[model samples]
Each structure stands twice: as C-alpha cells, then as structure tokens.
Target: MADHAEHTEQDKREKLKELVKDARIGMLTTMTTDGKHVSRPMALQDVEFDGDLWFFTYADSDLVAQIRANPQVNVSFSDAKQHAWTSVSGSAVQTDDRAKAEELWNPLLKAWFPDGLETPNLTLVKVHADSAEYWESAHSSKVVTLLGYAKAAVTGKTPDAGENETVRL
Candidate 1:
C-alpha cells in the first residue's frame, strides 16, 4: 500500500516535470495594486522542482512591485504540439542573489535587459507552488477522437496528452 502511494506521488511529480519540460512560455498572473489580475508571458527559466519553480525577472519591473504587494501568483504553461497544459498557483518572492540570477540567465534574455547580467534590474523570482492543476486532451474536437482512440486500442500506441489530465487552468 505504501509503495502504491509513493508511486502515485512520483507519477504526479514526473507528469508535472513533463509538462514543465515541454512548456516554454507561460502566462504569469499577479495581483495589481488596483486589485485586478494581470498576466503576461514569461519564460520557464529552469526546472528546479526539489519543490519550487524558478523564474527570472527585472527587479524593478511592475510585476515585482505587484508581487511585493501581493505574493500570490498564477502561472500557466502549454505544449504547442501535444496541446497538453498545466497551471500553477502560488506565491512569488523576489531575490537579490546575483549568483542565482547569473545561473539562470541566457543570451535570449538580452532582449529584455540589454544591460546584460550585471544589469541592476536583474533578479530571480522563486514560486512556491501551493497547488497545481493540469488539463489536457488528445484533441478538443471530441467528435474526431472517438474513432482514433478506438483504433489505438487495437494497434497499441501512446494516447494523446489530453486523454490523461484534468483542465481547469
């Protein structure tokens, strides 16, 4: 019984990792000063799921201020090819650690901060995901999938991403 429970937890972690691996740009939502939800696309940055998700952002950006005022934030990621998606709700905290920021930055981020890694605005945001919900379907057009899933039952192949997860993000 313990083994089965452990397997279930491991499976959930692996599935979450898979979703994060395929997810590049994700929507980051935070509460604004006016009490409205504001979301914008942000890169995955890196996978550090010992228990948290890591992200990079400008220290002085509006999002940072928003997070300061309200730590709660929501993030969403999707697989363009598989149409699988995951959303995480959590608290966001800004960091001033230069080493961590340097470790996560890439050349592509130059577009956001031309001043380079040394840019005074450079920082890392750690998201302690309180809970996550995932949603996926082989394809949203259910009318088209009935025949295909039936065919797979005979041929034996992997089903599409959506067949296995719930969607509420």
Candidate 2:
C-alpha cells in the first residue's frame, strides 16, 4: 500500500509537469488585505516542475506585498488546443538568493528589468505546491469535441468531461 501511494504521487507529479510544459503563461491568483481575490497573468518561467515553481518580480510589486501578508496562492494553466488545464495551490515566499535569481534569469525578463539582474527592486517569488487538480479531455481534437457535443445535444445526455484528479504534492 505504501509503495502504491508513492507510485501514485510520482505519477501525479509527472502528469502535472507534462500538462504545463508547453504553457507559457499562468494566472496567478492572490488574496488582498481587504479580502479580495486578484488574479494576474504571469509569465511561466522556463524550469522543470519539481513540487516548486519560481518567478521574477519586483520587491515593491503589489504581488510581493500581498504574498507577504498572505502566503496562500493559486496558479492556473490552460491549453485550449490540447484541452488541458491545471490549478496549483501553494504557499509563496520572497527570496533574495542572488545565485538562484541568476540561474532563472533570462533575456526576456530584461523588458521588465532593464538593468537585468542588477535592476533595483528585482526579486524572486517561490511557490511551494501543496496540491494540484487537473482536467484533461480525452477528445483533445477540435473535431472530436464538436462531435461529442453534437452527440450529447442530440441524445440529451451529458458530454464526456474526460479526466479530472486532485493530487497531493
């Protein structure tokens, strides 16, 4: 039973990585002090998912302040063409590790930080994922989906929703 649980965990992690591999952006949702949910599109950094995700932001950004007050956050990814979507729940922390910042830094970030890593207020946000839920449709092709909908409409039956699972990280 223990072995099976471990295998399941590994399988979930692999599936998550595969789902987000090609996604370039994710909606990062955070809670504000007034108890309002704010979501913004964040560029997904180019890194392997290993129970943690990283992003570069400004120290003075609202996102950083919000995380400082409330660490809980959700990052969501979707791929319309592939009919895949995932929502990752985690806690975020601000880090000042220069080495890590350098490692994850890329040329594209220069637009936001003109001075590169040396840019003032530059900071890293690390999200340690606790769990995630993903939905993947079996009929990924457009034609198949249309056909499924058509069949469902004609038969007055619910359309096949495909697979959905929640995994603990």
Candidate 3:
C-alpha cells in the first residue's frame, strides 16, 4: 500500500512538471488583506528550466500588497484544450529584482505596466511551488486513449487511469 502511494505521488509530480512546461499562462489566486480571493492570469516563467513560476508586477501593486499580506497562493496552468492542467499551491514573494523582472518582461506586458521597462517599481513575483497536481482528461474519453496504447507498447506499463499515477516532490 505504501509503495503504491509513493508511485502515485511520483507520477503526479512528473505530470505536474510536464503540464506546467506546456502551458504558458495561468490564473493565479491570491487572498487579499480583506480576506477576499482574487484571481488573475499570469505568465509562467522559468518553465523550461525550473518549476518555480515567475510573474512581473508593480512593486506597489494591489496584488503585491495582497500577496504580502498573504503569501499562500494557488496557480493554475491549463493547455489550449484545457484537457491538461496543473495547479501549484505555495508561497509567493514580491521582490524588486529588476534584472530578473526584465529578463521576463516583453512588449506585450506593457499594456498593463506601461513603465515595465523603465519603472523602478517593476518587481518580480516568484512562486515557490511546494506541491502541484496535474489533471488530464482522456484524449478520446470513449474506449481508451491512443497515448495509453503507445505507452504500453513502449514501456510495458498499463495505459489506463486504473493504472494512472501521481507523484509528489
């Protein structure tokens, strides 16, 4: 029983990483000082090399204030089809890391932060994903998925969700 749980956790972590890698945008949920939960779309940075997600914001923004008041946050990443999604729950930190913020800044982001390029208020919102989970709907959701068959043929592991697993970090 313990072994099975361990394998499930391991698979979840791996899947979570993969989902995060594939999805570029996510809805970040943060609790405000007033105790209201606010959610907004954010870009997923450091995806290719790490699990830590980075987002750029104003140093004195409302979101920054909310996050500072409550560091616990939930970040959700979903693919175009929304069939695959990952939710990362962890603590968030607001820092005046201009270089890192610039590294992630682009022209598109200027629509919100007009001074993103030059404003000293530009800051980095880093989420240290402590635990995450990936939920993937079966491709066809009819008989069985083609990916399942492919996995069995290649690795000899069962391709069914009955054989599905999750992993923890």
Candidate 4:
C-alpha cells in the first residue's frame, strides 16, 4: 500500500511534466492588490520541469509588478485533445539573471523582443511550485467520451469523468 502511494505520486509528477511539455502555453493567474484574480496567457520557457516554471516577460509588465506585490500565483495548462490538464499553485519571483535568460532564449521569443536578451525590461519570472493537481481522462478520444455519456444515459449511471490527483512538489 505504501509502495502504491509512492508510485502514484511519482506517476503524477511525470504526468504533470508531460502535460506541461506538450501544452507550453499556460494561463498565469495572479492576484491584484484589490483582491481580484487576473489571468493572462504566458508562453512557458523551454526547460525541463523540476518543480519550478520559468517565463519571459518585461520587467515593467503588470504581471511582474503583481508578483512583486503578491507572490502567490496559479498556472494552469490544458491539452484539450488529450483531455489532460494541470493546475499549479506557487510563489512567483522575478529575476534578472542574464545567464539563465540567455540559456532559455530562442528566436521565437524575438517576436516579442527584437533585441533578444539585450531587450530592455526583459526579465524572467520564476514560479516555485508548492503543489499541483492534474486531471487526465482515461479515454482521450472524443468518441469514447460520447460513448460513455450515451451508455450512462441508457443505463442511468454516472459517466466516468477521469482521474484527478494532487501532489506536493
């Protein structure tokens, strides 16, 4: 039983990484000083997930300011076709590490900053994940989901929604 629990956590962490890797764009939600949640789509910096997520943004951006004011934040990723989704809750910190930025930098990001790493106001936002919860449907196909719904309707049973698990980083 103990082994099973440990394996489950290991599996969840691996699954979270896979999901995030495929869905590079995540909705980063930050809290406003007035207590309102503001979410914006941010491109995930290319890096291996190890309980931390990095993103490139302008130092003077509203998001950077918000994180400085309130470190708590949430990042959510979704792969609709795979029926996989993950929500990560963490504390965000803004860093101006040129070496790290240069390592993660690529031509695609040049669209946002023509000057690349030298672009003024370019900064990296790091999210230190405290915990993450993910949901993955056993049946990834839309057809399978529809069949499950139809079967449930005919048999008066609840459809199998999927699997949900929370793991602490």
Report, for every candidate in turn, its global Cα lDDT versus the true structure: 0.76, 0.85, 0.73, 0.88
Instruction: Report the Cα lDDT for residue 83, model 4.
Output: 91
Q: RMSD in Å for candidate 3, one decimal?
A: 6.8
- lDDT tens per residue, model 4, 79-169: 9978988999999999999899988998999999999888999999999998998877879798998899999999999888787778788
Best TM-score goes to which candidate? 4
Per-residue alpha-carbon lDDT of candidate 3 for residues 25-88, written as tens digits (9 for 90 to 100): 8999999877889999887766523357888877888889988889999998877554676778
Q: Compose the digit string of candidate 2's lDDT tens values, residues 97-160.
A: 8999888888998998999999999999998889998888878697898899899999999888
User: How close to the true structure is residue 115 of candidate 4, measured as C-alpha lDDT?
Assistant: 93
Per-residue lDDT of model 1, residues 70-93, tens digit only: 999989888756557788888889
Worst 10 residues of 3 by lDDT: 160-169
lDDT (Cα) of model 3: 0.73
Clashes of 4: 0
For model 1, the stretches where C-alpha displacement exceeds 4 angstroms are 1-7, 139-169
- The clash count for each model shown is 4, 0, 10, 0
Of the candidates shown, which would achieve the greatest lDDT relative to the real structure?
A: 4
Q: Quote each prediction's TM-score.
A: 0.77, 0.89, 0.72, 0.90
**Candidate 1's C-alpha lDDT?**
0.76
Q: Which stretches of candidate 2 lie over 4 Å from their true place?
A: 1-7, 46-49
Ordered from best to worst TM-score, the candidate numbers read 4, 2, 1, 3
